[model samples]
Target: MFGRSKPLELNVLVLRDADVIATALRTALAAAAPEERPGLERAAALVEQAAAVPDAALRARWVHERLTAAGHEGPVDSVRAVKTLRESVPGLGLLSAVQLTKDAAAHRP
Candidate 1:
């Protein structure tokens, strides 16, 4: 006879709005230890500030800043930049990552 096994259950919380994320962070902050409170508070504030910006704009800015900081600009190491973009920005399509990488390369000083 085969042994009985428990069914697997999954719970998922999707945070589509920045306000929702900030509220969750705030809730976590109330119970966070002294050492962890600062990080949670800062995350909540950042989410609130970013709430006004569209997600696409935020992703673009982050990609630009990361590529620039990594010195992957001006067509140099562009392949790596694409990889970095895809890795840093989850769910970013490959074509979009390539385009952003190319655009960054073109705008390099």
Candidate 2:
């Protein structure tokens, strides 16, 4: 009689929380001004596209660009938004990005 075979298992990796991000984006869209809603929606699309990439750096860059572009009015609002987003996402790059924005705003005339 042959010995019993052992069962095999596979491991899976989670990249990002798309649902959480989507919910956050929806909240942002709802809170946005009528004129700003379009831009915010566009930014959300950029984030969704970035999520497809497996590399963290690339994803961070995409997020950074969208946030930077959306930050046209004031640094304080931008900083707050970035901080809130960082909390939801959780990453060093995001922290640095928010810090850099704050630093730039501080030095501006």
* Model 1: CA > 4 A from native: 1-17, 24-47, 75-94, 102-109
Which digits, one per residue and each the tens of the lDDT, describe model 1 over residues 21-94? 88789889999999998888889878878787654455455567876676555553367778876776677666
lDDT of 1 at 19: 71
Q: Considering only N, C-alpha and C atoms within 3 Å, which residue pairs clash in candidate 1?
A: none
Once model 2 is optimally superposed onto the true structure by TM-score, how far is the C-alpha of residue 20 displaced, in angstroms? 0.8
The TM-score, computed over Cα atoms with residue i paired to residue i, of candidate 2 is 0.35
Displacement of residue 47 (Cα, Å) in model 1 is 4.7
Would you list the C-alpha lDDT of every candidate in the order shown? 0.66, 0.58
lDDT of candidate 2 over 29-101, digit per residue (tens):
9999999899889878977885766544444444445455555343432756566545544553554556544
Candidate 2 residue pairs in backbone clash: none
Which candidate leads the pack in lDDT?
A: 1
